[model samples]
Target: MKRFFMLAFLVGLIVSGFAFKVIMVTDIGGLGDGSFMDGTWAGIVKAAEEYGLEYEVIQSKEQSDYIPNLSKAAEEADVVFAVGFLMSDAFFKVAQQYPATYFVGIDFSFPEEKNLPNVMTFTFKEQEGSFLTGYLAAGMTRTGKVAILGGIPIPPVQRYVIGFEAGVKAYNQIHKTNIKVKSVYANTFTDPKKGKEFGQALISEGYDIIQQACGGTALGLLEAIKEENQKRANIDNLPEFIDDLYKNGGVFMLGGDIEQEWQAPGHILASAIKRVDVASYLGVVKAYTGEWEPGNVELGIKEKGEGISRMPFTKGLVSNKLLAEIVYIQNLVGIGKIKIPSTEEELKAFWLKGIEIPF
Candidate 1:
């Protein structure tokens, strides 16, 4: 994943936001790749239009570029947005160096008792949203096998993995069916070739559904799915609906960080929606109004920060009944009746305690 350089973009913000300067430093995925970075940039773009703000984007090509990109942004920006959890360490270093600059870190985690006067970070309950995708994958798989693919084995990515597996297990417990889940990691977010290779191999191995949590690496996985679907499409009657697709050996993918359902359409069942855009937009609002404070905020389903998306691409193809079940589970999670796990111990306890089906 790589972000391309862009000329500074200006849009009309709200009255208070009209005079602010904002800059965003993308994670390794950069922009596009149909995931997280895209969502972050969308927030900046939206804030610009709604608040009359001037913004610039600095795309980090690799891990080493984080400090430099952040440093460059803080030099001029009234507020600097560090757009990934991977940049947490680098973000803090930059924030300290430029104490006058206010910094907002999206998907940033705060280590124990670590707070800065000039920094605020937003962390999402990615596990909660990811749980829904896991359930969807389990419910839709005809082959009884699904997979979770991550760009790296970091805690954030692990949260997605944990929640997904817990969801699949929850489904299995409720339905009395045995579904297998596999977790794979790319160790790097930038390699689409490796991602595509993993996708094809997993598909061949009979894991019919794969949930992609990786950033740009997922681009290759999507490409793999398209290729597989094409190979399978040369049949008498290709299935137009999800059930038909499942029955005909077609594969599905669920994604995270943004709406990637449109990336592969039918092949991509849905994406667990994380409102990184909302977090970014609000960060600017707070900074512009001088309400900015050093703190960590965790937004989840209850806060409208994370959830499953409405199936727009798959539309009529996805079953209404299945969609209902997903929403039911999502609502349960949103209401705190269904506590999805974010760690190994909790996931273990979750399975033992069982998921509550909100009918």
Candidate 2:
């Protein structure tokens, strides 16, 4: 009887040790930024609730917090997640230190030189979704001019810009119309003031439609759009371009990351949705199930990794014909019928293909 009790106690200990613990480290934007961090956290929460796994999140307030937070999480958690491209280097260093723990990085493709067997990176084909939004912007614009605001000129942000430009160029070629697109980068993701300044400037320059890849800074841009529209409502005998803007509620804004149509209701035309939550949830599930694969993985529309949102508010606002056209483009890109440019050289080649720039 003594030996039987001792064997049962050892079995209980082994079973308890297999319970999964997950920890996530957010980038500088943190949890409430209503963008990347929020999306990733939602996924972690979902996985924990469904799988009965233990989970925690560390919000990084600055770049310096990355390494320490990752190291701390690595020490305790069965699996640690680094939630943005900014955390790539820090994750790499800490992951090497904890070879026994599984590490996953979102929005990061582990470099060839630093590939670790215990580390896995997930990246999204953001350009494909951005291309769809750009096409929508070109078709929806009454002013023949649209603009894109970027938080930083990083590779991920640049992918959106390049795909957007290509979509606009494709629209011009097909319709034989002169539609102009302007892109500007604010160089920071957390500054709403700069976002508002850039937004107001674009509106003043006669851009009636705007797309943003500026993360939290996009909130300020949305605020500017609301305030500007209210001011324009009181004006008398507005110009043709001004009349167009007034009729459409000042300006239409396109969002990036998660669906942001509810953020400003009528002002938000649509959002280029990157499903970071899905990727994060899958990573935790794989690690918990002992099915974790350590390598670089890229997900696109075909894999249901990225997409564009068509909210209820946009239903009657955007014509069925236009929506159908956008869907057609989306399907083409998803099935490899159309290749969206993600690099500068590819963008240049795509634009020069039988399409002449009028501006």
Candidate 3:
């Protein structure tokens, strides 16, 4: 009996040894925000099922949790993925200690360092997707006025804003339209109060649709839009806080970084998605399967790694003619026929072409 028990134990150990171990440390927003971390988790779960990998996830409650989480994962995991730009410093510190364990940093870039051979930094061309959203907003707006709200001026955030404005100008010039756009920077990524405040301010200024580029701040923007809905039912004069001097119905919000259309259903028109899931998934698969490559991997509209999502909420809401035009543009942009502007000069030239907004 003793000999049989020992043999069974040995067989179990052998089976467990085949499982690849992965540990993930998520951003401050944690698992339930229905955004990047959630998307990454979905992909990880798929990999876990397919590859028989043992995996664990740790949520960072604050920025301070980053380094500790990284260190913990490095000690146990064959490969560890650190999500978000907020964790960059933490990752750098942990990487120095765990020189043997592989590290994947999503939405981050690092100076080339041969000594940190185990660290792979992945950054996305979010502006590419933002450009599509901007073009669509320009084409669809009926008020001849649109706006953008950015959480902060970080390179990633700034790129989205720049690219979006450029796309708007491109479509406007092609159609010979003049649509005014107002942009505001909230200067903070996590505060919903500032997002909502800026959103209300934009609406009062005659901006009808505002694209929000902050994380939690975007959620606040949505809240402000909802408040606009409540106010529109009451009076012609909008509050000073929400000084919109024009347009009849409530204002709308567009989300960035993730598929945020579901956040407020009808309130959020579309989302410029950065495919954090695909990025995370690819990283895990590469590491697990021995296909991992160092250096930068950029995903954009051309690569199908990022794009805007216009789900059914827009059906019947946007005019058929406008929808058709957007579809045509989408195909063109996707196929490289319509080169969406990625620079300030490119955007200005596109708008100079004078393509007008449908509204």
Candidate 4:
């Protein structure tokens, strides 16, 4: 009996020694919304496969779940990732308690963390991508007006909006063109009905294109567009104008945070994608390897970490001249040819002064 006990103990020790455990805590949005959470999970899986590490994920039911899920993961795993900006407060609290365990906060910024070496924060300049997409929308609109539909007027969403406006203003200044935008926030992250209503209102106002930064709410906006398209079935070149006030007035949809090109093949011009997978995976790898540093890592078009992706569906739809112009604008932002605004104050200041990047 003594000999058998000793052998069992040895086996357990060896197994524990080799186990490289990691845990991921996702936001209330869940894993597979074809959005941010899914992108983060993709990176987690990649790291697990590449580094021979084991990972477990806890899906958050709401904001309240952030602390508990993170605490639970910290108890067992080598490192934990608190995904989403919504999890920032919870992550800070949990990290303070478990000073030894590593934490990575995606889109969560903390300049002062009580010197918590275990917590690392990551953010991206989504405005950069948003600006590029906004420029595209301006150039594509046959009419001088475009509309933006957003999930919520949160900081992140606001960043995209500010960037979009700045981009449009800069493009006009550069090319000496006349283009303007009408922006609205749906104010809810997942309300489809409101989204459709907002889209309808924009169409009624003679807006020719829309940039959708909303999540599930964007689905309704797209549905509204589809319904409008159906009514113009027999029309030539898809009716330049339709009688229905809710109909898409030659509107094009641009999505953010996910590649929504397939959601509407020809209608969705492009997508502004946040590479959450890469961010999450890097966090895991850092924690496991003992190189995890606590600080903010900001990504943008310059970093190739986030940007607007040209869709396969519209590969040939946008004219070559238009495509070249869009690319030029993107490259300008990427290489500092055009300095886009990041904050509300900066955006206001830039436009007020009519300042243009000399690039």
Candidate 5:
């Protein structure tokens, strides 16, 4: 697909009467998942309009499409983006071949010893944001249980799971109650059918609050939550909104990377937001001004890159006291006073350290 947007004249722009060409290669999830990939694209479009650049998006149908698509995009792209961690291998290979083009990889990380002169990378501190959601889930869960649905067991998705468990463990320590978090992986980020099955099964097993880091596969998770909400609404003759639904009897899901209430309205609690849009937009702006440089940017709560959504549709479900506590923990996290675990090994240690609540 092609999109051309015109930016108002910026005298400071060194465009020299030319527009930068940008290309975005999506993972198997493509777009419209109301998740991270979509968040990345939104940034691309915003940058294109701001700089009056021509942009094209190519959706990869499978993993095999990665190398060829990135190669093709690099052929004419002044700046190109490879979205998703799954594409990092293909991205590194193709970026090496095209030294003239600036390449951006979303959710890609390189070892400290390595550097690619023409490539820049963006990695989010997903564990930090997921910690907030996990805390919320623990405080709000009616069944004393929550869950995590991971698309794959990659580092990026693992961070979401481990951090969530840390938050639950923290809450358990503070309240002297055991709230369990069950994590499962589908091993695929694009399979909606499997995602739905996992979501429904978790709910059946009495997990009332679930957090999903499954990309497009999460579309199915939302569907299951919507169905559950509708069933409970009808059975209880509930109101239009999910106000106090947790206190009632409906299940809920938290999304990752973007605000996803549009996917399931009141059934979606909130999303652990990662500011991919900001990163993508800034990448374009820097490229336009000759400020583009190859480097790694790791964004977390301190950088305004990790957090949770505003809960536009389900505001009433989260109590004000719970919201206040979330903020308290968020500030502690932002200031580095609280360190969240992002790996299985770290999670184990975190439990032993215990959550020390000064209050």
Candidate 6:
């Protein structure tokens, strides 16, 4: 009878051990940003479903709420995820306060001074994916003009622009085409009006393909493209406008961060996908399975953490030959054959290496 009771007690312990709890603390964008926040939440949900873990999220309405929300999540959950680079300071503070709990920071790189053992960070090589998008845009642009829209002048967003410019330069070098690339920063991630205004201005200036790295603000760019397409539908004999529209069924907009091909079917050229969901889900799984460790995890095309999406829409729009070239570039980057520029210094060095810039 004692043996039977001991076995039952051990079973109960095992069951309880499997029931891990996770909590995500979102940045000021909150849950409905339809870009970064939503993508991270999708990973959390996937982890919960796959591991049978309980999960909760605390959405911050403003910058001031970051610390409190992260602290609250750290206290309540076995593993806490502070989503977005904006919460890096708060996450570091909370992780230092609670050394016993595991903390994960998405899109964050920990400073060398604050190297906490219990804290892990996941950062993506967004430039690699953006490079592919720029390559595709250069190939698909009929007007020889492409543009990039950024949410803010942060490093992560800058990486996208830098890589995009490199890809365009590389394409121009190989094809002897003078493709012009323009970039703009909205200074806000949530303002769709600003996105629309900038997008419209670019469209009027004969920029046919616009790639957006802004968060929710990108939705406005898509809306502008749709509205412009409708306005020009009745205007005949406009070969320049017609050629731009014919290249990809309409003015092309490349998506960033998440798989946004579904956001606009034919209008979306491709998405530079940063797999935050994969990172978040894997982080939670590791914590739950006792494999969690402290360090920086940099995911890139090699690790399937970031790449371009080949959704049905993209497959239909992008040619097989171009897709093959994009894949080749992806593999080259993954294998260290192609070095993508991520910083200002590196970009300058790249340009100095006999790469022509169309400006």
Question: What tens digits encode model 2's per-residue C-alpha lDDT throughout 1-359?
Answer: 99999999999899778778999998897777677778888998898889998999998999999999999999989999998788898999999999999999998887889879889888988888888788888888877899899987877888888878887877876677789999999888888898899999999898988889888888888888877776766444424434545355568788888888777666677888888889999888888888989998788889988788865456566667768777876777788767888998988777434433232
lDDT of 1 at 151: 85
TM-score of 2: 0.89
Candidate number with the higher lDDT (1 or 4): 1
Stretches > 4 Å off in candidate 3: 1-5, 114-116, 230-249, 337-359
Task: List candidate 2 segments past 4 Å from native.
Answer: 1-18, 233-249, 351-359
User: What root-mean-square deviation over C-alphas does model 5 reach?
Assistant: 5.2
User: RMSD to native for every prediction?
Assistant: 6.8, 5.1, 5.2, 4.8, 5.2, 4.9
User: 1-359, model 6: which lDDT tens digit per residue?
Assistant: 99999999999999987667899998876776567878989998998998788999998889999988888887789999998777888889889999989999998888999888888899988888898889889998888999999987888889989988887877776677899999899988888888899899999999988989888888789889878776756444444444546653568788888888777665677888999998898889888888977899999888998788876554655667777777777787888877889997887677424433232
In candidate 4, which residue ranges exceed 4 Å CA deviation?
1-13, 234-249, 351-359
Q: In terms of TM-score, which candidate is strongest?
A: 5
**Compared to the true structure, candidate 1 yields what TM-score?**
0.90
Comparing candidate 1 with candidate 2, which one achieves the higher TM-score? 1
TM-score of each: 0.90, 0.89, 0.84, 0.85, 0.91, 0.88
> Among these predicted structures, which one has the highest lDDT?
5
> Model 4 over residues 226-270: C-alpha lDDT tens digits?
666656543444223232212434566787776778776656777
lDDT (C-alpha) at residue 167 in model 3: 63
Error of 4 at 15 (Å): 3.2
Model 1 stretches with alpha carbons more than 4 Å out: 1-18, 235-247, 352-359
Quantify all predictions' global Cα lDDT against the true fold.
0.83, 0.83, 0.74, 0.77, 0.85, 0.83
Better by TM-score, candidate 4 or 2? 2
lDDT of 1 at 220: 90
Q: What TM-score does structure 5 among the candidates reach?
A: 0.91
